[model samples]
Target: MQNTVTIGKQAEQYAYQLLLQQGLQIIEQNWYCRQGEIDLIAQTNDTLIFIEVRYRTRSDYGNGAESVHYHKRRKIISCARYYIHTHPAVEKCMIRFDVFSMSRDSAGEFSSHWIQDAFQT
Candidate 1:
C-alpha cells in the first residue's frame, strides 16, 4: 500500500498539471513555513492562488476535499500569509484559496476536482 506521503505527492503533481493546463502559471510547489505547508501556489492574471491538494484511495471516512476542515484551513491561511509577507511583489495581488481533490475509483482510475475560492482567510 502506498503511504500517505506518497499519495500526497502524487495528488499535488496531478493538481499542478491540472492548474497548468487551465492556464495558471506555477509560482511554487510545496511551500513550507513555520505556520504550515501550502501544497501548490500559482498565479492567474492578477490573482495569487494558494491551493490545498487532497487525495483519497477510499471514501470510507470522507472525500479528499472534505478532509480539509477548519483547522486545516487555518493552517493553510497562516502559511499563505507568510508567503505574502516574504514575497512583496505579489502582496498587492488578489488572493484566492483553492482545493484540489483526487480520488481513485474501483477501476483504479484517478479523477480530480478543483474548487475555486474554496474558503476565506
Candidate 2:
C-alpha cells in the first residue's frame, strides 16, 4: 500500500497536469509560509490562485474537498496572505482560493474535481 505522502504527491501531480491542460500557468508547488502551506499556485488571466489539494482513498468519512474545513481554510488563507506579502508583483492581481479534490476507487482509478474559488479570505 502506498503511504499518505506518496498518495498526496501523486494527487498533487495529477492536479498539476490537469491545471496545465486547462491553460493555467503554474507558478509554484507546495509553497510554505509560517502559517501553513499552499499546495499549488497558478494564474489564469489576471487571477492569482492559491490551491489546496486533498486526496482520499475512500469516502467513508467524506470526500477530499469536504475535509478542508473552516480551520483549514483559515490556515490556507493566512498562508496566502504571507505569500502575497513576499511576492509583491502579484499583489495587484485578483486572488482566488481553489480546491483540487482527488479520490481513488477500488479499481485504483483516480478521479479529480477542481473547485474554483473554493473559499474566501
Best by lDDT: 2
> Model 1's lDDT to the true fold?
0.91
Question: What does candidate 2 score in Cα RMSD to the true structure?
Answer: 0.8
Candidate 2 Cα outliers beyond 4 Å, as residue runs: none
Regions of candidate 1 where Cα sits further than 4 Å from its true position? none
Candidate 2, residue 90: the lDDT equals: 94
Cα TM-score of candidate 2: 0.97
TM values, all candidates: 0.95, 0.97
Query: What's the residue-level lDDT of 18 in candidate 2?
Result: 93
Q: What lDDT does candidate 1 reach at residue 98?
A: 95
lDDT of 1 by residue, 1-121 (tens): 7888987787788789889999999999999999989989999989999999999887888888899999999999999999999999999999999999899778766799899999998
